[model samples]
Target chain A: DAGVTQSPTHLIKTRGQQVTLRCSPISGHKSVSWYQQVLGQGPQFIFQYYEKEERGRGNFPDRFSARQFPNYSSELNVNALLLGDSALYLCASSFPSSRASDTQYFGPGTRLTVL
Target chain B: AQTVTQSQPEMSVQEAETVTLSCTYDTSESNYYLFWYKQPPSRQMILVIRQEAYKQQNATENRFSVNFQKAAKSFSLKISDSQLGDTAMYFCAFMKQGSGGGADGLTFGKGTHLIIQP
Candidate 1:
């Protein structure tokens, strides 16, 4: 089966603008998570959705938001984008039934650049 | 909140030689999990190995093995016969066991860049 998939492999926006990133979880997976990876640093968790409900959220600001669809796909929206918002946005998926020890599979990520 | 640390910013080793990358994490939760993920220039995070806090034995996958010390809070990865393909950014991550059935987000370290010299 295919791994988690993300869209618009790359994106560019100016400061004060907005952008939406999309993700499709792996088949049969019920949970999706979002992470932001700045250049030369590790990824930081942004949001996690399970069974179409918001399960967890990271320390990111309110300008960042996400939602999961009935099909388990997810979208991350960043408003009032700052230069600091430029980073590779990653999406991960896992089976909720597997519980805590489940390993999340990540996507190639959407590279967002803000000028 | 939990914090994962990778002290080594970078490391270089000759091909076919063994190298060990170190990591340490701070967490009050006893039923947590630790992981080592590798990200090549391609930029997708790949799971190398994982260890559960409750497990006494370390996790091993092919040439990859982990030394998981629950007390010391140290989790290190050892690569045997390292190959050029092994070159990548290595990250140590932590996840607290959640009471709910959903998966939790991972807290990652800054990562160590590992170079396998040819």
Candidate 2:
């Protein structure tokens, strides 16, 4: 089975521009989460959606938002981007379960460079 | 709130040698999950290993193993028979157990960059 897939591997945006990153989860997966990784740093959680509803949200600002579709695909949107917003946006998908063993598989992140 | 810490920013190991990457976390919740993720140059975050807080026995996957100490809040990854493919950035992450099958997104550490010498 194919793993999580992301679109527009790399993007360049201006300070005030908006950008959208897409992610298609693995088949049979129902939860999708978004994370942002700065250079030399680990990824920071942004938003998590399960079954097209927001299940969890990180400490990111209002400029960042995400939604999941019925098919379990997701999109992360950043508005009024700042230079600080430049980083690798990652997408992870997992099965809906309470067990800790349910692993979240990640995608090749989309690198967003804001100038 | 939870925090994962990886003190060593970088480490190096010769081929076929064993290397251990250290990680310490702070969390108030008793039921949680810890994970070690590897990110290669391709920038894909791969799940290396995971340990549940409630489990006393450590978790291992092939050449990768984790020494999980719940009391010390230390979870270390030991890679045996290291290969050049092991060169990558390793991140320690934490997640709290939520109710109703919902998940608390991961809290990650400042990763450690591991290099394998040929």
Q: Each candidate's fnat, in order?
A: 0.50, 0.65
lDDT of each: 0.91, 0.91
Q: What does the lDDT come to for candidate 2?
A: 0.91
User: Candidate 1, which CAPRI tier?
Assistant: medium
**Tens-digit per-residue lDDT, B1-118, candidate 2:** 8889999999998999999999999989988888999999999999999888889999999999999999999999999999999999999998887752335789999999999999
True contacts kept of 2: 0.65
TM-score of chain B of 1: 0.96
**Residues A12-85 of candidate 2: C-alpha lDDT, one tens digit per residue:** 99999999999999998889989999998899888889889998888889999988888989999999999999
Which parts of model 2 have CA positions greater than 4 angstroms off?
A: B100-102
How displaced is residue A72 in candidate 2, in Å? 1.0
Question: How high is each candidate's TM-score?
Answer: 0.97, 0.97
